[model samples]
Target: MTKIVVFDSGLGSLSIIKAIQKISKSEIIYFADQENYPYGKKSQAQLSKIIQNSIMLIEEKFFPDFIVVASNTPSLMLNVTTKKIFDVKPPLQDAKKKSKTKQIGILATKSAINSKGLTQYIKENNFSKKFNILKINGSELVDLVESGKFISNKKYCNKIIKKVLEHRLSQNNIDVVTLSSTHLPFLKSLLKKQYPKINFIDPADIIATKIYLKIKNKQSKKNSLKIFVTGDIKKFQTKLNKIGIKKKVNSLSS
Candidate 1:
């Protein structure tokens, strides 16, 4: 059995896990490092060490064939041998590949915009020669998704998306709106409602597809899936339930 670890700061990785479940028959052990919630604010050095330490600790107890860093912030900051979604900046690449316009819009957390992985991806891709990228720090969007505030207040969510799309990329003639942050994909519907003309790129889907190709031959659905969280189990469990995940959430900090 292929044992894989899905690591994220909060429930954002659940989006990735859902995609994995549909594609591979690997036993999944998901860990949400709620103790270090909102990884976007942490320094790169701090995030690197934190992620390195977490992986080391996880390896001591459970050995997986590979690890999947599903969150965008940590995925960019950490230099691990794991199979990370943002390793090649797939979101940015997809944005450039699909759009014919000279301008593209990227919505990401504060850390992702500053991370070497993203910065380097942009610098090396010759994106500037082809398209002008307009980046907005959607760190507030990440917080809202983590707290389930968007689901609870749809009106406010719509308002937030409108403000950035209308103001930040108003004159850029954005052909694609890339949700560079994992959490931002959850707001895809709202974003579409506000700006139906622009295409929205979800990195989670690209990541999921890549993972499927990696394990497609060894796939089975009978593998076990476990979820662990560092914060309130009930709240986390509620989220799992809504996502049609019946698995019980165990306390990770204990």
Candidate 2:
């Protein structure tokens, strides 16, 4: 079977894992680096070290075919992509195509929003001058999902979503918004309900397709997933249970 490793700071990795399962039969090892939760708040230098260490540790311990850094903050704010390494990035092209007003919003974490890397990424995409790219800080919403509040406390999540995105999206008349953070996808249904007219784009399926295409020829057997966390296993397991992920979460010892 094709062995793959997918990881992020917290529960966000589940979004990518779920998507990958839909299209490919691969053995997956999911690492939740909750010890370094909120990658958004770190400096680029700090995040670079954390991501590099995590990547080295995961590779050393798991020795999977490839590894996925599933967080948008590190993906967009640092030079972390390689042949067998994949990172999640906002689907700006898709947003541009879907947007009638040409004002597309990228809902990502704080560090990603403020990073020069993200700005350069947009520029590299060669979006026309008519296209307006709005970067919104969604760290609070990411926290909601990481803390298990998105599932346990809908009303509160709704409030934070409105507080963080509603005004900015409405003011700019952004017809399309990309859920840039993997954690943000957990709030998609709520976001759609609150902003009915705006089209929310999720990159999970795109990411999944990319991974599936790469490993599909390997002839994997039944799909399987093993989870690990760098933080409290008991607490993280409880959070996972709330989201219906009943798999055993092992402690990352590397």
Among the numbered candidates, top lDDT falls to: 2
**Residue pairs in steric clash, candidate 2?**
none
For candidate 1, the clash count comes to 0
What digit string (tens of lDDT, one per residue) describes model 2 on residues 1-254?
Answer: 78889988888888999999999889999999989888989999999999999999988998889899999999998888888999999998888789999999999999999999899999988999998999999999999998888888999999988899878987898999999999988999999999999999999999999998898789477899899899899999999999887989899967
lDDT of 1 by residue, 1-254 (tens): 66778887887777777777766678888898887888888888888887877777677767766677777777666666545322324477677788887688878788887777777667776766767877778988887788787778888877776775687766787879878777777888888888888898877767667777877787655767888887778887786675557877888752
Every model: Cα RMSD to truth = 2.4, 0.8
Q: Give Cα-based local distance difference scores for all models.
A: 0.75, 0.91
Worst 10 residues of 2 by lDDT: 212-221
**Residue 146 Cα positional deviation in candidate 1, in Å, after optimal superposition:** 0.9
lDDT of 2: 0.91
Question: Model 2: runs farther than 4 Å from truth?
Answer: none
